[model samples]
Target chain A: MRFYGYFRSSSAYRCRIAFNLKGLAPEVVTVNLRDKAHRDDAFLAMNPQGLVPVLDTGTARLTQSLAIIEWLDETQAGARLLPDDATARAEVRAFAQIIACEVHPLQNLRVLNYIKAHHGQDQDGAGAWCRHWIAEGLAACEAIAAAQDHRGAFAFGDRPGLADICLVPQMFSADRFGLATDAYPRLRAIRAACEALPAFAEAHPARQPDAQ
Target chain B: MRFYGYFRSSSAYRCRIAFNLKGLAPEVVTVNLRDKAHRDDAFLAMNPQGLVPVLDTGTARLTQSLAIIEWLDETQAGARLLPDDATARAEVRAFAQIIACEVHPLQNLRVLNYIKAHHGQDQDGAGAWCRHWIAEGLAACEAIAAAQDHRGAFAFGDRPGLADICLVPQMFSADRFGLATDAYPRLRAIRAACEALPAFAEAHPARQPDAQ
Candidate 1:
């Protein structure tokens, strides 16, 4: 397996964490999003959407961080990331999508470009937009996490699974944007627990080969 | 099973159509997003994200349309929306996420509100912003749909599976934005095929119980 990613991409970071957690390390093939490499012919040949964090299974490439994660959970065997029960899967998935779909997309490079070009937001303005969305999403996620009675130092249960994989990266981005996360105590605690793990630590953007 | 949805929500519409195809006809409840009803106490009890298209499976409430649809696909045993093979399932999910994760989130009402307040886009400017993203997304989707040889007239093959369920609603929103999708013949054709079906037609946003 191979991975296409950029260090600063939270989505890619999520994938890296998943790959590491599943104890399956794929060859890291960097797609330089900053230089518009994703839109270049070679990358488009791999993913038409030109998004980062595509997992290349050698036979097929998977797009979308959540989809890649799901594919991993389904195909892999050891320490399953998602629970087997249908309802449990939905619960974990909802938390993941709250981050992956609702929060991350608003703060992506393309949306940032739109803000810069169409909205005339400076870097700080862009960061503010990013923070605002993160705050809203994190608040909702906090509600869900706090509601979990069975959790043992993690977002869902004792194990750091799908939701934890997604949560940690977003908080990383949030800290980068200088967002105040004191409101989400559960998120803070769970993130601290996840950060202590070797898998998430190794997958940090600053640790990636493409880090500038 | 019961589904709470707003008529114009492409996300909700996707789940509704899936339920229809599966012959589940989950008791349909309505959440009017325009009135800020999704964020109301009653609705948030079901989904903390306060987003529409929450599918209550009797055991728990399912948020995220893709997650809900997938759960239904797995547990309901009806139309078999996903392919049996792993690679095939990954492909279908990748296509679905392009719209669900990448496209839909950008055009959502909350983002438009932010654009209006922060970017100084009036309703018209916000709508323009919406269309621009739609065009960019559909262009990628068109490339994707045309690139594959699915078995059916749908986005993948002949079967109206998950990708098509996601695609058709996205196309509906595209037209609502006055996007000149004549350039996207494959998308339009696939959408026409899906829309022509009673399941898709009945799932149209305007046809929903809370359409007014």
Candidate 2:
């Protein structure tokens, strides 16, 4: 198996945490997004979306971090990434989607670049954009986490499952944009619990081979 | 079961298709997005994200269309929303996320309103923004679908599944924005195939109780 990703992509970071949790280490290939390697024809051929964290599973290639994580949970032997109960699983996935769909895309590198180019946003403006979406989405996540009937040390249950997998990365991003997460006590606590684990710690952007 | 949604919400439309496919008719509650009904304390208490397509399953209220659809597939008795094979499931999910995560969020009412309020984009500007993202994302979806070795009439297989559930609504959004989808023949074909089915037809925004 081979994993293609950049060091700082939250999407790739997600798959990295999933890999560590599952106790599988695929050979890593760093696609330098800073250099626009992801836009190259070679990378586009591999993934027409020109995105990171493409998992080549020998037999098939997987795109999208959540889908790859779900596939890992289905076929992998180690820790389960999703809960078994249907409703619980839905809760975890919904939490993940709040970050993945609602928050992350609004502040994606491409989106920021587009806004900067066409929407007249400079670096500070883009950062503000990121912070706005991050803060709003995290507030929702905190609310949902606080409302959970059986909240654990993690987002969903006692173990660090899909929700934590998504939360930790978005928290990292929150910090990146200088958005203080202190307002979200539940998310802060969840991030603390997740960061203490080796799986999440090792997958941090600062720990990657391609980190500057 | 109770389903809270807005007629024009693409996310809500995805769940409506899933419900129709699963043959489960949950009680429908239309939250008027134009009137900001989702921001009411009552709705916010149910969904902190203030988004539509919340499914109350008596035991638990589910948010996030993909999560709700997956839950329906896992617990309901009907046509399978996800394929059996893990790799196949990932492909279908990746296709769905291309629309849900990458495309839909950029054109969301909240995001567009944010851009208008802060980014100096007028109505035409927002429409352009939506078209750019919709075209870019549909191009990726088309490329991926065209690359599939076993292309079926739908996005994945012979029967409509998760990918088609997402694609149909996104296609609707594209048309609403006056974006021509002719460039994405694969997606156009998939949309045509999906729209021919009663399951997809019944879920159209025009057919909803509160469409106007």
Candidate 3:
């Protein structure tokens, strides 16, 4: 299996974290999102959406970060990213969407570019835009994390699953935008727990070969 | 089961259509987004994010429109809303996210309000904001729909699943925004197929009891 990704893409970052946690070593090929490589015909054929973090197994080429993560959870055995109970699964998924759907989409490059072109937001404005959404999302996540008594040292339980994989990167992104994760005590503590594991450490963007 | 939703909420529309097609008759409870009813404590107890389209099964309350839809797919056997094959499932999910995550998120009321408040974009500007993002996303959906050759008439294979559910609400949304769907031929054909169904026809926003 080959993971085609860019180091800075949060969706790829989540996949990298998953691979590390699962103890799977797939070959990593970097796609330069900065240089329009993702939009190329060959890459677009692999993924019509021209998005990053595509997992190419022998049989399947997958897109969408959350969906790819779901595929991994199903096909892998070492760590169940979701829980066995249906209700718990829904909670974890809802938590993941706090970042995937709410936080990340608004701060993404394309949206920022659109804002800049049409709304007259500059680079600082974009950065501010990113921080604003991430902060709002984290505040909601903090409340959700605290609500779960079953939420272990991690977001769901002692083991880091899909929610944690998604949470850490959004926090990492939050940090990038100069937003304070300090208000999210539970989230911060979980991030600390996740970072201690070599699996998560290995997948950090700073450790990725393509890191700027 | 009770579904909390609003007529024009695209996510809710997607869920309503899915519920109808799956042969489930969930009691409707409208969350008035315009009146900010979703932000109330009562609604937040069900979905902390305070978003509409929460499906309560008496056992577990579900949030995140995609997650809720997926849970419905897993718990029911009627329509098999996702593909049985893994590759096909990924494509179906990817297609769904193109609307759920990419298109609709950009045009969501909250984002539109942000544009109105912060960017000082007036009604026409706001409408343009809606049109621009919708056009880009629908164009991408058009490309994706054209790329596939399904055994059935729908986006993934012949059946109506997640992809078709997503496509229709977005098509309905585009119509609500007065955006032209003529450029997207495959998408238009798929929309026509969906509109021909009673489930979709009934789920249409205008047909809902609370529709203004």
True C-alpha contacts between chains kept, each model in order: 0.82, 0.93, 0.54
TM-score ranking of the models: 2, 1, 3
Q: What DockQ was computed for model 3?
A: 0.65
Leading candidate by DockQ: 2
Better of 1 and 3 by lDDT: 1
User: lDDT tens string, model 2, B1-212?
Assistant: 99999999999999999999999999999899999999999999999999998999999999999999999999999999999999999999999999999999999999999999999999999999999999999999999888877757988878899999999999999999999988989888889889889999999999998989
What i-RMS does every model get? 1.0, 0.5, 1.5
Candidate 3: tens digits of C-alpha lDDT, residues A1-55: 8999999999999998888777788898999998989999999888877889788
lDDT of 2: 0.94
Give the distance in Å from residue B150's predicted Cα in candidate 1 to where it truly belongs. Answer: 3.7
Provide the overall lDDT of each model, using Cα atoms, as 2-decimal numbers: 0.88, 0.94, 0.86
In terms of lDDT, the best-performing candidate is 2
| C-alpha RMSD in Å of predicted model 2 compared with the true structure | 0.9
Local error of candidate 1 at residue A115 (angstroms):
0.9
> Candidates 1 and 3: which is better by TM-score?
1
Against the true two-chain complex, what DockQ does each candidate achieve?
Answer: 0.82, 0.93, 0.65
